[model samples]
Target: MAFLPTTREEMLQQGYEQVDFVYVSGDAYVDHPSFGCAIITRVLQAYGYSCAILAQPDWHNDDEFTQFGEPRLGFLVSAGNIDSMVNHYSVNKRRRDKDYYSDEGVMGKRPDRPTIVYTQILKRLYPHKPVMIGGIEASLRRLSHYDYWDDKVRRSILMDSQADLLMYGMGENTIVEVADALASGLEAKDICYIRGTVWKTKSIEYVSDYIMLPSYEEVCKDKRTYAKSFHIQHENIDAIAAKVLVEPYDGWYVVQNQPPLPLTQEEMDFTYSLPYERTYHPKYKYIPAIEEVQFSIVSNRGCFGSCAFCAITHHQGRVISTRSKESIVEEAKRITEMPNFKGYIHDVGGPTANFSREACDKQREFGACKSRECLFPKPCNNLIVDHSRYLDILRAVRELPRVKKVFIRSGIRYDYLMYDKNDEFFDELVQHHISGQLKVAPEHISAEVLDKMGKPRKELYLKFVEKFKQKNEQFHKDQYIVPYLMSSHPGCDLNGAIELACYLKKIHHTPKQVQDFYPTPGTPATCMYYTGLDPKTMKPVYVARTHEEKAMQRALMQFTYPQNYDLVYKALKTAGRMDLVGNGPKCLIPYQKPGHFPSRRDQGKRYGQKPYAKKGNERKGMKKR
Candidate 1:
């Protein structure tokens, strides 16, 4: 009688259609409607679920790496923009000029990204699907960590990326409870009973307790010896069973472990009030600067600045929850109704972005209270400070009417903006929101690797750069803030890089850039930048930790980019520091090697490098010397 339309009345009429769920990410970074994993896969397809992202995953393209539309069921993985626990550590050499320029990999096997061949080409083309994995480089390699640039003990990234599970931290309620338990069909060994997750069945290893970082190196050298070392408790122990060996010619098993239960500020403010729209509406669909650009809103997460070469104090737990400011002006009015709404709102402070909502008075008791971030892992507490409801939600989304200016552009804990009684939110963030230059990290000038990267006191970043150059010359406006400095971390040397080229030759200020310190995966200074030695002064230091000392610490963070100022002023006057340059001050950084600035002449034809070439060897600029 009804000539057509009857696949159960076309599935009883358009309601449940949650497709494949594929995700993937090796790292391309912010481009689609401006990414945060394409706004967390468009907040899991607006909570109905049918996601599909895939940035750098080619895995020898079998019809373009499987997942042919629907029935694929599972697979998330994610380098989540390189931090896959700092890509296993080479410290990407002295943190090489912003966003990891290279420690190992400028190119070579990208086949898309996050390799073990993106999990052996998604387990030889989805033989049974359900892969999972999470970000912050698979949650600091999910288990059995502590590499410190490979000094040892590493295995449990679900046993090196064979991955059938691993969600780890900051995954907003474990990604909507693993997409409502695989849309209620379950199985991948019953989604490993879910917690902060980590599973494996046909060989055994089901970890659930989740925090873990120091998996060795004498428990990453103490914290009551790594919480009585990676526990196997058994005492009042709720659940346990051991004797494992997943491979040494694959045989033994009996593993079953359960322990993780720490997330709560109402589960971190219900993962910062996830409805996560930040624009792209007409019923939704707009992630494209290639994916995302300057419209991220967090308000706060975890970061007590315990630098020990940061792993965000082993992934977001030094507790600091915050979200309120009327849920950040309704996520900045959903990033100003999208479709490229750039009234500038790139990032709104968190993880040390002015210690939001005062880190709920000491969450994980790291030697209990007595602030200034438990002493110089920096954020210097003149204590008691507040963002006055995050500067009244950045002055009510810059007085909205199509919001145009509101960038506290991320990293700015300049010792809590020189906290002399919270200097008027650091003088109204250097007179109304700085966009030109303010990045601040002060990783090291080396008070012995800022007390092993817990930082501060290298004479307090020159008294917060002479109180931010006398509050920008009392607003005479010469505005510039830039000091993210980190140089060869683990107790640095060359007397800590010539005492950081003699404190930029007595703070006249020469740093066009300098982050030289690489050791990424599971930090604590990647075991002192890959064991050049300094397990607390076991001597012998000056390690750039190779790759030619991180290319001379990436040509030593351009000591003032006037084309590497005469070879960074002849390597800071041959590491002698020429009595810190002159005249009233602010500009005297020459260790030579800055050559042809303007981003190496806009990376001259992308490294064929020909901006009026004649200097030879890739057009090496400046230096008539």
Candidate 2:
């Protein structure tokens, strides 16, 4: 199986007069199953659709888009695996210097909003061609969303891009349906009844049994309405029982069909079994993104741990799907045979590593509970917290020939692990999977903040930490637990920040980096950030919106650093906790350090310099200025 044709010449050489679908992607062509572009195109190929890759095309001109002339069927567009804006900039909106997905890790290969930009270019170049958008950027923004960069509510990407159809969530199922529909000569707009798709309609007369969200005008005018709209969207994400959602904007309505059903284990296995070249196209000497996932194997998809800040629930759904152990081991064997085989497998995990099964049997039939969470506050009684199957898969992978270490880099939900009564998997994880350190996200220590973030209580995390340490001691391994911390989350006020700092000090752990809360679209936390109201309860919530306040919260997380001295001191003072500014061991900073630079409190004035002293001495030695 050769790599997909990336150029028109290659397509012609492959004996195709015109490809069925010209897939435009923001990433360089990497024919690996881990890349969504590879998965979709390969799936289409398996079904006998001729697809060619048009990756990282020039956004400024239509010439690049028309390189393949026009697809016989339609154009499939995606902003790669990640959202283009996130790929291009940091949380602080600073332009990133490197794009791991691009050829040779170069930056600026694609436009800021590649999905919209590329679709617009296609529409302009071939006015009547069907443009279909999918992937992370389109999936999460399938409805009205708050744009962090723009600091305002923006219409759905489908609306902005004028894409004929928007395939949300995992596109394997949706894309096939779309292709079949288009192949049968049904127009794109008329192919609206398919599951896991969003399409525009001029009239709502045809929409029935669907929940109507607040109009775009209403949501934009009233924060409460926006919160209500988000709550409705969040509740009905299940495939079993979710109703179709309709969001109106001006005269047109964006109708989101029910989510696609969770893929069966056999389907998952077959998807990964596709013939992928498993590396970048030969044109590129290197692609940094492949390095991270080349040795890794994804054994599962979906997550039951619906964290508030995470968009997985909205995008991947909460249903867990796992491939057969045989399928995974087969993949691992192929990985060991690679030319650059290093006798190590990077990871065999997914959205949540230990979530290898559905949360409960009812989830598959009755769907997830609308009002309650599966693992927040505490695990639901119906939660099936088991790790035996996951452990079995890991053991099989470890037993593979030429495999030295199989680390679980994809994070495990510690609270979910704690829910399991069995300790065999936990012990094995400590003894085997961990490299030097195991990372877990105990986002915040404050119970209130954790509740707001939809994370487990602080005590749950503390218990897990204690158990992890005990297992490490029993195994005689000096592995450390690196806790991932977040700052300035919706409910994290100055007090919450101080409490978190105190906890970190008690644990004697200084994180190398701290993540300030970013309110990206399609998350509950983002809703709170935008509306200052918890959609679930409609209660007022505190949000750290100002740059100064967010900075202070971040600095408090790393108060031990000398450079953070001033910010910590100011935060302590502002919070009416100046008591924490003394030289006491309990204090975050010393009163003497008035600024980031050194100073002497005994002087009762500025230290390290005297105004005009150097100039005065120089004047004494020379003529006056």
Candidate 3:
């Protein structure tokens, strides 16, 4: 169980003249199961294919890429675990200074779009070698979609990267099929019929029984057409029920086959049981990305809670897949034996912790519903709301020989928990799982905003909160719920933000951080961000696109902070909520004199200036930037 060869010397030491595949990635090599590059490379190795890794190769030239030389089969490329653009920029489109995926958390180690950059570089260097791109970046951009950073529609990445194929979704199964085909002497263009892949085709004369989406021209020209096209794509996400989808360009069509079938319990067990180093490569002293997942165990894959802002539904699909309880506990025992074992397992969950089985029995035979959601609007009657299996696994891990505590850090769907008639799992969760705080996403309290987010209504979250409080009290514990709040989602305006701020005031809860709606590609909310229409219904939606408005919405969430006083005051005044602006008990803030909202003392050093301390204390703490 050695790490994959990264240099030519290491490849030669392994007694190989040339590897079968050279996997390029934007992230530092962390051969943990949590990283997609690790999974794909390890799976290929299991199938008797020699592979080498080119982790975060310098994109300035082909010098670094030549380390692995050429492969016998082809090169598999991914933009790390996260999309490179999202990794490099903030929600405000500002270039972020820290990248967790790089050595020492440095930024600019990889270019903005590594899938495109790396593939284009490979094509120029190798010319005829097969190139395939996958990972969150390629999976989301496999179709023609909106580009938030560019502020325009972009064509499929397959067309731009000149890569022969783009594998969307979890690529364990898709990679094997494509790799086998390539090994059998099939060219990239000829390997078109595999599921969970998008490929370029000059003619669809042989294609049959596929839905032809609106051409790239139509979606770019008309917002309504774009909305309609996005909705059509959303409806066909399930593998069992979905048909082949084709998006037309001027000359060629980008065809997406149905998603790969969800993995079975046996397959899920085999995937996690593979030998992995479970840490970053020894070359680097430290990588910030490996801290959280070093001791974590992934119990499941895929999510059914189809939030509009999340791309999990698009990439992992809504179908839930789980590992057997024995498989999970076995991993926990191994974690206990690590040299740095701390008597604690950081996490025992995946996309959603409580989802340990299929959404319903029908989901296995048929697929998740095409027209409606399983939890949003309301829980489906057919929805199976049980957490017993997950509870059993948690109990088993806790009883392991050297493990002292097991915690669940990944999100738990509170709405789904609230819908269950049985409260045993809920009670035990409050007692055992949480580490003094349970984090959940309510997103927003406004009904309109929640609707646009495809989240449950506010009433459901409130009920869950009350139940959580009751459970904590019953166990004689002091626990709190750290609700994940977002601002300026597609349907949110000044009034919506104000409504959420008022709710926070009522509950005396101010979030430590608020997530501004980021419109990355391949999400229903992103489609709304670009077209100003809800892709689900094609109705007009209010979007806070202006910088001032988006700031106001964000500030309203943290209205208690002195730094946000000015923005919050303006938001309240513009919304004509003057009644709530006075010095009453229910007032958000005291009225300040006109043009003198926040004093210099109140502004403090938050505005990039040295604080003016009191005259006597000035000499006590005087530091210059």
Each candidate's TM vs. the true structure? 0.32, 0.95, 0.95
Worst 10 residues of 2 by lDDT: 599-608
State the C-alpha lDDT per candidate: 0.54, 0.90, 0.90
C-alpha RMSD in Å of predicted model 2 compared with the true structure: 4.8
What alpha-carbon RMSD in Å does predicted model 1 have with respect to the real structure?
A: 24.7
- Kindly give the stretch of ten consecutive residues in candidate 1 with the minimal lDDT sum: 233-242
In model 2, how large is the Cα lDDT of residue 457?
85
Give a tens-digit lDDT track for model 1, residues 91-191.
45223222221212343324322644586667777768777777666666554544554555565566666767777656556677777888788876677
Candidate ranking under lDDT, highest first, comes to 3, 2, 1
Candidate 3 lDDT over residue span 287-396, tens digit each: 99989999999999899999999999899989999999999999998889899989989999999988989899999899999988999789888999999999999999
Model 3 TM: 0.95
**Between candidates 1 and 3, which one is better according to TM-score?**
3
Q: Which pairs of residues collide in candidate 3? A: none
Worst 10 residues of 3 by lDDT: 616-625
Candidate 2 achieves a global lDDT of 0.90
